[model samples]
Target: MKINVPFSIAIAVLSAIIALLGYFIENSLLNQIRSSLLQSAIILAGVALIIGVINMMRVHWVEMRGGKGNKIYHLTFFAGLILTLLLGGWFGMSNPNGYWLYEAVVVPVEASLMAIMAIFLTYLLTKIINRRKDFFSIVFLVTVLVGLLTSAPFLGQEIPFIATGNSIVKSLLHLVSNGAMRGILIGVALGSIATGLRVILGSDRPYGG
Candidate 1:
């Protein structure tokens, strides 16, 4: 594929300038320009998402018309999707009926899926222990057990030691999860900066056709 060097460099330079202005400038005009650009980006994203969903629905509808084996699943998906959209459109999402629909239908479905995932994860852990009697396997099993036990309701109320253990587990979990999330975000930001610099230098041409 041939690279559109000029176009790519232009895009990268413009993006860098806009980003710098947004971050460093305190002028009202600059701030308004930044806000407008952000809003335009958001609007574009929303339109893209809608188009993607419509395309997905169209593909599924075609599959259903073709009498595929998964037609029933596709039908159910479209039915649920259309019903949810209709309800939300007719009555605002905050309306009693819409809220009830979400609470009564969506919440239970999501909860049921989560419950199933917990069972599946437990099964996988047991399988791993049975298959591998290694130190890491033991540690994994112990960690899973500790997490489950600490999070269990009512057990901490009855036992003082369990309450203390739960508090420690919660603290450790929060610290580890937050640290990992921050590391991931930092990595992403750095990667984006590198890519933008590459494009601006005309070393990379993502817009090539």
Candidate 2:
């Protein structure tokens, strides 16, 4: 027997609407339903993550056994994953060791990745500027330049933008961070709504697979 996809989508959409309504409504029943829905969602998300991780591990294990090129990358990945899990388990909740690993290794690695992204963005902007000298391109160039300037000091600036508590620098930092986050989140929300609508209309049968 085929699964009832329409029935499933109806339940999903109803549950979502109830959950949203619970936030604005003052009814106890609505809140309880919303809480149950949220718990169900969390469990489903956790299961999905576990399934994804297992799939990844299986694929990587097969590649490892193939004994082909770049075995070192496979070895490094398993080593790091195992090490991270061991550290987290041993450290428990009050984590000095886990925090140390994150600060020592992860932070610098993430920062380096971000720096590379900025470099690529600048390169892309140069291409855009050459192709089209538009208002938006100019704005993009200016934004990139300001972001780069505020991020680091050149030659150990004697005129550091240091105020009493460097409030000016902090303000600009917060402003930029908040603006970028809001813009990204708004885009995500819009895309999510569009995808959900597609699912609802059965125009996209993601569940069929």
lDDT of each: 0.77, 0.76
- For each candidate, what TM-score against the reference? 0.69, 0.67
**Per-residue accuracy of model 2 over 95-120 as CA lDDT, tens digit each:** 88866667778899999999999889
Per-residue error (Å), model 1, residue 1: 12
lDDT for residue 198 in candidate 1, whole number 0-100: 79
Could you tell me how far off, in angstroms, the CA of residue 198 lies in candidate 1 after the best superposition? 5.1
Best prediction by TM-score: 1
Write the residue-wise lDDT of candidate 1 on 1-209 in tens digits. Answer: 23565656676667657756788879888788778877887898999999999999988888899987687899888988888888888888989876666888889999999999988977887899689979988977877676665666464363344435448666787688699899999999999989877766667766551
How many clashing residue pairs, candidate 2? 0
- Root mean square deviation (Cα) for candidate 2: 5.4
Model 2 scores a C-alpha lDDT of: 0.76
